[model samples]
Target: MTTLHQEHTAHDHEHGPACGHTPVPHGDHVDYAHDGHLHRAHAGHYDECEQGGHVAHDGHGHAHGRDCGHDSVPHGDHVDYLHDGHRHAAHDGHWDDH
Candidate 1:
């Protein structure tokens, strides 16, 4: 017998710690394009190998993630942010809360 896996993506960046969900942290998430926008996922919600944040999927099931999307470095980019001061670039790559 064979099985098929379907992935559903959605945009949800407005969610913050204020919503009672812990911020998953940077570099521990993936942003997928959805509905003309990008949606981020936490390690606890996806198959993250590098970090032990993998979520087990029982045959067919969905999981809700908390605390994610803190890392902003591109896949091939070697960029590091500072603690103090902010880097203002055109479209810093973060989802604008507009």
Candidate 2:
């Protein structure tokens, strides 16, 4: 997928451990999950987080889909499940943590 350069404009609040937003450990930097979207701090602004590659979710047992009881978030193309403070998406044959 060609991820766009998206920035969350007009956002005044800062994101960190004390910001009350859930901090997710993305590749190198951290992304804060607010509402249902992931935001990453950029140059004086925040951008919608889009991970470069898939990070396998090892040992995942739960299957996320319709009627899975978890909140389904509309990601780029597929759906991501809001699971335990993070997001999960079905990959090749496993799951990926977003």
Candidate 3:
């Protein structure tokens, strides 16, 4: 009779943030957080929609349409930015993985 033996091993790994973005000051602006993202709006800048409604600002002196591609990730009670594929989490903030 012949018999065979098998061996198994377990490994552990660590993961950091997912994206590569840093939060830069967009000037004196207000932010609207929604769906794990932040939508910012700055003064003096306006985003006029086809329906004649203001949307968002671009930090510069210009306005953007409804799709003003300035979305940031939402950390635990904090805001995070993703740039160059790097994730920049907010400092002195807690990370909620829920």
TM-score per prediction, in order, is 0.19, 0.58, 0.23
**Model 2 misplacement above 4 A:** 1-44
The residue-by-residue lDDT of candidate 1 on 62-98, one tens digit each, is 1212333233322222222211121111123331111
Model 1: lDDT equals 0.27
Best by lDDT: 2
Which residue pairs collide, candidate 2?
Answer: none
TM-score of 2: 0.58
Q: Which sections of candidate 1 miss by over 4 Å?
A: 1-13, 28-98
Which 10 successive residues of model 3 have the least lDDT summed? 1-10
lDDT, candidate 2, at 84: 76
lDDT of 2 by residue, 1-55 (tens): 2234699888888998899876766556777767667788988899988766667
Candidate 2, after superposition: displacement of residue 57 in Å?
0.4
Worst 10 residues of 1 by lDDT: 81-90
Please tell me which model should have the higher lDDT, number 1 or number 2.
2
lDDT (0 to 1) per candidate: 0.27, 0.78, 0.30
Candidate 2 local lDDT, residue 32: 76
User: Model 2 residue 86 lDDT?
Assistant: 67
Please state the error at residue 71 of candidate 3 in Å.
3.0
Which residue runs does candidate 3 get wrong by more than 4 Å?
A: 1-70, 92-98
Could you give candidate 3's per-residue lDDT for residues 1-98 as a string of tens digits?
A: 11112211121211123323333233242233333443332232322111122222223232222354544556446544433332333232232111
On TM-score, the stronger of 1 and 2 is: 2
